[model samples]
Target: MGKLTRRADFLAANGGFRAPTPGFVLLVRPRGDDDPAMRLGLTVSKKVGGAVVRNRMKRRFRELARLVLPEAGIAGADHVLIGRQGGIERPFEQLAADLRRAIAKVRK
Candidate 1:
């Protein structure tokens, strides 16, 4: 429902529950503000690739979030997708499935 633009938000999410997939690590942190809206953040470090690759990964992630997060994401929480080296090579369908699986795991 929103984007997390602050470094602090991302850092806060780092301390939350994590679900690791082949492509990415998903982090879910409840804000406790009772807003009922989910905020999303994406990170692709230089360790993964250069700017172009990172941008592409982010674009894919944005689309993935659009498709999946509305239904699967936790309410009033920050959800971050941390790109791994495997992410750029992974199939889009597989990545989507990975995200879904991550969400399911975090919900438990």
Candidate 2:
């Protein structure tokens, strides 16, 4: 429902449960606060590519979050998608399936 913008937030989420897929890693961490909204964070490292590639990855991530998070995301938690080297080359449908599977794994 929202974006995770703080460095502390992203760092904290890094310490939580993670599900790794071929295209990316999904990290989920409960905020332990009153807010019930799910927050999203995205990171496409320089190792992935230059600015254009990273930005493209981010845009894809944002779209994925918008489409998938509402029903599948954990409320009151921060969900982070860390782009993998294969992410840029992967098909969007496959990436989406990967995300869904990852979230399901973390929820268990």
Candidate 3:
């Protein structure tokens, strides 16, 4: 999966399908013109914690994205993972499972 670097891309995904998981909220939107690659964005809001905590959560989210997206992510779509408080403390395996489930839900 490619990294979503543009602000507009994130905004577009925010307006798309949403699937809430125990560890995070997943947002997905189709790439209008058939770009075969899937893009990923991560959001760890200040409401979740202080800078240090938020960064940690982002790191975890990045890892999860790398591990899960290549195999399960939809082509021609953008996915944004919004981190919740639970993401910081959740087990890695469970977080990965949550992501897989969320992806499946959003695709439906």
Q: Which candidate is the best by TM-score?
A: 1
Q: How well does each candidate superpose onto the true structure, as a TM-score?
A: 0.98, 0.97, 0.94
The true-versus-predicted C-alpha distance at residue 44 of model 2, in Å, is 0.8
Residue 60 of model 1 has an lDDT of: 98
Candidate 3: give the clashing pairs: none
Give the candidate order by descending lDDT: 1, 2, 3
Candidate 2 lDDT over residue span 4-104, tens digit each: 89999999999999999988999999889989999999998999999999999999999988988898888899999999999999999998888889999
- Cα lDDT of model 1 by residue, 4-95, tens digit: 99999999999999999999999999999989999999999999999999999999999999999998889999999999999999999999
- Regarding TM-score, does 1 or 3 come out ahead? 1
Q: Model 2: which residue pairs collide?
A: none
State how far residue 104 of model 3 sits from its true place (Å): 1.0
With candidate 1 superimposed using the best TM-score fit, by how many Å does residue 20's alpha carbon deviate from the native?
0.6
lDDT of 3 by residue, 1-108 (tens): 688899988998989999998789999999888788988899989999999999999899999888999999888999899998778889999999999998898878
Off by over 4 Å in 1: none
